[model samples]
Target: MRKLILLITLTLSGTLAVGQTTQKPPLHGKHWMAITGKPLAATAGSMIFNKGGNAVDAACGILAANCTMWDVLSWGGETQALIYNPKTKKVIAINAMGVAPTGATPEFFKEKDMAYPPEFGPLAATTPGTPGGLMTMLAEYGTLSLAEVLAPAMEMAKGYPIEAQTATIIENQKHLIKEWPYSKKVFLPHLGEEREAPYPGEVFVQEDLFQTLKKLVDAEKEALAQGKNRKEAIYAAYARFYTGDIAEEIVRGTREQGGLFTMEDLAKWKVKIEEPLQVNYRGIDVYKLQEWTQGPAMLQSLNILENFDLKSMGYNSANYIHTVYQAMNLAFADRDFYYGDPAFEPKSPMKGLLSKEYARERAKLIKPINDPEIGPGDPYPFQGEKNPFLHLLEKQNEVIAYNNHGTAILGPDDPFLESFLAGTTSIQTADAEGWVVSVTPSGGWVPATIAGNTGVGLSQRMQSFVLDEKLNPFNVLEPGKRPRVTLTPSMALKDGKPYFSFAVQAGDTQDQNLLQMFLNVVEFDMTVQEAAEAANFNSYQMQSSFGAHESKPGAITLNTQIPSWIRGDLKKRGYKMDFLERTSGPLNAIWFDWKHGTFWGGSSNHGEDYGIAW
Candidate 1:
């Protein structure tokens, strides 16, 4: 261990700080920074930064480690990232999410007399897209050789012990891991026995995964040859994984175990890089993953919040949380009803249903204080530049406006909206002063499959359908359709400079965590760690296929710290409350360097991660 540390320090040309722990310092000043869900992964990103890689390069590095050290939560899944080039002042998004097979239909399950399996199933599985997306980013933006970028992950895979977080996930999802022989082969030794804790610091190796990576890495040069598209080479690697002997064996194994993913499906699969959903919040442009997930819903929530007085409401107070809950409900109601792959018929009240002008009108319906009689928002609005939706908010102002307190009141029509509150948020603040927010819902396709051979546990992401039963435009389930993901990665810019980048990883809890973090930083001026450690809440006031553990219609769940007295008062206001122990979302962030051109970055001690620097 000491030798490895010396080698790393020497490689990066840095002196060891006295009494420095195993973790590296946050990259300060014009240097690059990278963070991830795991310490090793973050270290991988840091290594890339030290090797003259930029944010994109560091991202690739972290991704590599995610596949290795954080396999359970990382790869063999979807990926989405938001990137900004400070040099060019341009922001771009990458949506490399897996998609359902073209031949897949919800009715297929019905025909099989099968419930849409929760995690792994033909329907739950989509063609994996992360590998392709990584290749795309590397080809388009990365400066390091593929070999260099992947080296850290390979080493991590071959050396060291299992991380605590990875062990926990392994234990939590033991059913899924133990069911497959291949999976058990990789993780069981560490666990010692079924349901046992993975011994901390125990060395683990993913020999198969390493070989797969090596295979792809070995093809890089041949792939880059003239007249041969680099993207095609990348796709070929996946093809081999899914359609060749590897995929055939997976399908055969899963089929023998009664799983339904087909080789034809894998062979025809492709990763699509779709355009991100765009919105304007406070004149600042924001992009989300579209209808396949909570990306657009998050934007809608922001839009609704714009109509409220959050700045004056005071952060995390009962009143503040109540208002945000209402906003989220209103936004997500539309999401559940209208979002799906746009290539298929999708329904959205906000789709020409509400224009920017109409959104302004809808904003007027919200009140400052709790509204016991929240009304159902209009599903249809008058069309065109001059739409009747614009007039709706104008008409009802007199009856609801609070004469004494200047707040909006709930009306009869409010019952159309469900009342629950919950979501998670994650933020990454890097040494380069790069800030991002990534929030995703947990209820998407995950966990289940009919005990399979290939060992790929599929997801039920198809539930994110539009009202007309079509997939959301951004979430179409074509060969390459990225699942409609709720993951929203956000960055805040102040005075034409990057201030913060925050991303949340919780499936549904993303929204709540993000709202709190923003308040902590922008309103309360709390440091990143404080915001992450603070108790949080979740509200589910919308009709969502995504189920909440604690939320019920017209109700919410708060961390136990929420005063019990507040719960009684909230119930009286028609809000149901469930107090919980430890309802937290990992909130990772990097505060930008305002002086000396260095960035300050950190991860939530709330999570099993560390910050890395170059």
Candidate 2:
């Protein structure tokens, strides 16, 4: 009877989202499942999975296809991933995030009369990381050759029917794309025509990009001919990208466009495989990338919420909503001040920041009304050390107030929403063998500057760095330092086995929605699809990581479906509210059904995210 009502409610509008649980039906895969931001990318994963590759190989395939299609990313972006190694029974973290070049410093940007890095152009690029990340993951864990893994993307570069999303993005960004000579040549093929960009179904050919891909493949083939093993051959291809002709062209192109990249910056950068951070919520162990990313914020939120009986509060009720919002803001407050690259000096208090006791102390400060002035707490004491940056934390709000003068304030409904919007996508893959991989690869969206003739887009992740120590002493930009990023992929283990792999693309709101989605599944017993499709809320209380790096205190965005009573309750609690039909997500997930020895995949209809299984 409930399903009938849902069917009627949906059919009245138009065609179904092809299938429906929340528009898309839950897909059950007995063998394997591949899901990503675009249907074509997911198909690439399926193509590899069907060819006997493991989850890691298929994931690498999808990553490559996503880059080729430019689904909010390009070859020169960054990639952070969480992989469950079935043989080792441990989750591993892959940090392929690029770092600041030799001349990148707070003084350098401030000299340009800027508070933070620019949003576009060569000056905004970081060292390329996605290519290295893809090769490293495939060489270490995949069974197929590099040529086989990149076949789909190679075909795509040669020529493929363009989707409306990419076509429109290219056309709209043509003005900026024209600024870079190489990008102009590649993205605007019909410059003066009525529609400079290709039509929706027109074949978009990237001959230069095809040659670049061909060079890497050729490098691998030459290495194999010289008797190199599969892994060694793959690394040979990797070397050609970073230190050979490809690197030379990239360096020349970026420098010609006034970028900071140098041969040293590209060569010195390498992928890091480290242990993932984890916090047990109830019996489920949730894992996230370390402090270098905002991933730990989600872990911290779970710690605070674990103190409450969320199941009793009921899902999306006024009380439940309030508790979760307070927890996210509390966690993000810490993220803004304390998260940075652990590889650098004055290491962040990750121990204390992720401490459960510290979360309890922070939760004590939550009031009935939103406290707009909520500042960073002293986590060092929780780790048995004195706070080294106490003075810095004291004047945090004053610094924010000063920065707000330069910040742009836009309402929630505006297309140019100031906070919580980034160009990114999530890749989730799992197979029958217990191999699971989750990734949030982003940067180098459309309007990206193409480096020389390489056809590789440069990452604009440099804007994530702040030039002032007063804002984030831990994250102040310097040569070879990684800026604190909002990209986070997630994994969960149940009773020492891979239980779930998930991620979403929403900048600062990434963890806020992820926290609610986790609770929706664990506390409320919703299926993976239901949890993913659930309308979660967003709090614009924390500062934006991009653009002007502004914050909107007490501002909240809610789904229109919330009852008037609940809305009034929130209003009475001093929340400034705004409503939207779809307030959150493009979240993708895969549940490992251990008992049944199968996988359940969920791709949100809120976006172009799609999945395939058999």
Candidate 3:
């Protein structure tokens, strides 16, 4: 065990160095691999792979470990994953996003004179979907037992050296932590004394959380003793959290704190497995989740850009950047206005939105100069229905005002943005047999205050729901409806086989970064590592998906690596540009070269992300 940890540390040191400007080669392996935001979490996933477990098993381990190690990814958060089964020759989208509680209503917040749910309190929490999501993946797709996969994460919760990034996040949110005694007890140092945040290298322990995870393991053992199979045992373990004492404790805590979540909501929550939406670009089929996420926006943008010769425009050229930005703006405009819970409105215009014909029509609006007020297209015209938000899609001459008051943006010096930009912990694993998994497990961090002594936190995802019922019926706060989230994981298939799996963590930039990285490889012909390290740009031209739903029309942020001339040229073209020290989001990916029987893995250097292939 000591040797394994040592080897992982050395490998991670090398991998981290590659994220710098030196351009180190991608990590290559012939069998299997795992890459994630944190070194310890990656090590956990790699251990699962080394033990002969498949990609789904490795991903379960990775998700558990990430929840323990990174404050940004909590056990109580939601998870949106994409899995590809080589045996079935199919891709499945897992919508593990939590739903608003029954009591979550527009009138509930309107009485308080607030436009949205509180960003960091019990009121912001919903029924957590991560546990159900992980257990479901294990029961349906993985070969390993719950006890086996959760061991590493339990060990991490017992005591692990705090990483610099996690330490900084703790420090930044110390004030919020201080607000809840249980939260402060779990995250801060000297619980009731000086209240110092943990620093890098300090051993951090969450004994309560360790015990909580242990209960799940014990429940799985009990189920197995009752003659249940591995799958049934996994489901039994999920029940322990969702329908047993754990749920009771969470309900009591939230109710005591004046929150709306109830035991009924927790018991009824289930992760949905649905078909993924795909679009072929350059013979590669790119897949993303449907309406409940910002994923389709990327597919729409790709569809529009597919009509242009991006290669001729030159990489990062003003023409290429402007075109991509305009296309993304248009897609995001549609996302804000149209995308929502399909369950609430089964007639979501997804088919028409992803149609190539719609993309072509939307592309016609792109001009040489920046169009500051690009709005959602008439998808209803193509879908044979009336567009409900058409009236709200008015264009304005002035740049849309940015309401930054309730946003999560801490400040220029705050690590919050960089923490997310470093990307959430995304895990990808492809075993020797060709089973592939791409899972983005996030939520339950700084903005989400911890629940009482249940050893569980809650997600602030309720922030994504709108209080105005008139904005769009699809996104209006409603019981049992999932909010349109920004957590998107992507997969690509070539020749009917899994080619690559990738994801990013930044809110609005998640799909944008995915699209850019995909093109960087397929169109620009760059290696996985090179594509991740390459200069990248993201636009904020459309309304943000987070708190307040503010828009910064024509706003774009460019990596410093982009040449000065390119920035100068973009500015000359009426595009609003800002310089960032590094890529706006961290991109993690694994590329499978089936013909050569090799796996190449890469991750962004922006944060503490690392990749291990062996």
Candidate 4:
């Protein structure tokens, strides 16, 4: 009995010691880190880094795993990014946004009088650019074989335990899953009287996805040899999955359900890469994906912030938050009014959207505590400078409310209605250890009830559009046109050296969230972990807490940690208010500890994702 008791005590001590070591005293190495919205996705990226892959390779691995983990953001969806090449001291933009099908047009939608069918599912789908995007990056910069890089994802899809966050996502978005049989199978297999996720510790498999990737690897060498038609071996494989066999299955299933996707669309689709938008912020150059997303708008906001004394205002204080939101509203107003893809309009305003003079003009409209209603400002004219070449309009118009019925402002209905009306933003970041940022690509809360010509439901990409008379809304849905997105994947450079890479998910709120977070680090001088974990407000026009987009009433969100004194002071100044118990945006980030040559990364616990490094 004495010997047995001693043995039991020894076993308990051993377990405790193991747990202590597992806590990990911060990893040290030259690593390529990936910070994404999911733990499994991050794990896949870290594995690639461990296997001698670069940031690009890690990103591909993460993208694949993310598709299986969260259907809303990957697989046949758009992907845009900013990649930094330390060797050349240049940042490359991988613009994998889908192009408008040659068949899309504004007139087409107007003819139908349907407020641009929310483009989600098959008919609204653009040729998925991920294949081309990943391939292009691999062909240019990757050292690992594509087959090797893709292995982790194949393994993940075949079967892995579902994480707590992913399960919560499944529960929250059950409606989207119930719409289609395949979606339901992957999301919630019917379990005796009700649907439930594959239990934790149970192997979850995506046979179709796994089979599809295997086919790609088996034929990659042959596919590369021929431009149009690859070597027969690879060509046959790609056709069987993408066009011939698997394509037929997708088409048949879609048709039975009522979708507009056809095998021809998949066969004819190709990825398009365009010039990235560039801007200057306080002598530092910034780059982002073009107008199809709100990338340029982030550049514009930074440009405006450069004209202000953010560091002096203090971090997360009402004063600082006010300035940030004002800048965001001004930029977003321009976004709603002018931003869009250049190929369609040929005269889009994105080119001059981030001009220093333009930012200056936009900054002039902001009064310290005046609390002007939301729509009473414009960026171009506020800069206090005039353009000689272009005829600029001087407008400070107050917009009418969406309905003017004075909707009830109290009770559960109010919050529920507001939450329903807002959109979600995703964040991605890359570190000096090769971490990167890719906030998920879609826009707002889509109407799940509306089915596309393809039996699949539409995503809320239409919320990106705003009805503006003078400048064509950049977010308008044209069949072949990519909508203007707000996914801002960014890299920070200090003294021309790459400092960090970060991205957030929050639709139009992306720039605002990023701006506050960056200030939390650069201005407030907080530690990387603190900057990543700190609660911040996004002053963009999405959440009803900021009043209506049309109202444009100035407001600021306060992290609960903020002192009540600061909140009361801001309220006295007439700033409208909302207090978030949790940080509103999901931030994934990585910083290169230049001093130690190590990477420290964190994925926000506020969101269900995990941050990973090797």
> Once superposed on the true structure, which residue ranges of model 2 sit more than 4 Å away at CA?
1-21, 400-419
Which lDDT value does model 1 have at 455?
Answer: 30
Worst 10 residues of 3 by lDDT: 396-405
Of the candidates numbered 1 and 2, which has the greater TM-score value?
Answer: 2
Better of 3 and 4 by lDDT: 3
Q: How well is each residue in 364-443 modelled by candidate 3, as lDDT tens digits?
A: 99988887766667887777778765555552222243222233223456343343343456888888888888988777
Give the Cα error of residue 574 in candidate 2, in Å: 1.2
Assess every candidate by TM-score: 0.77, 0.96, 0.93, 0.80
Question: Predicted candidate 4: what Cα RMSD to the true structure?
Answer: 6.2
lDDT of each: 0.56, 0.89, 0.81, 0.57
Candidate 3 — what's its lDDT? 0.81
Top candidate when judged by TM-score against the true structure: 2
Q: Write the residue-wise lDDT of candidate 1 on 4-103 in tens digits.
A: 8887886577654554321233434356556667777777777877887767777777877766655333345556666665555655666666666555
Model 1: number of clashes?
A: 80
Candidates by lDDT, descending order: 2, 3, 4, 1
- Model 3 has a clash total of 0
Best by lDDT: 2
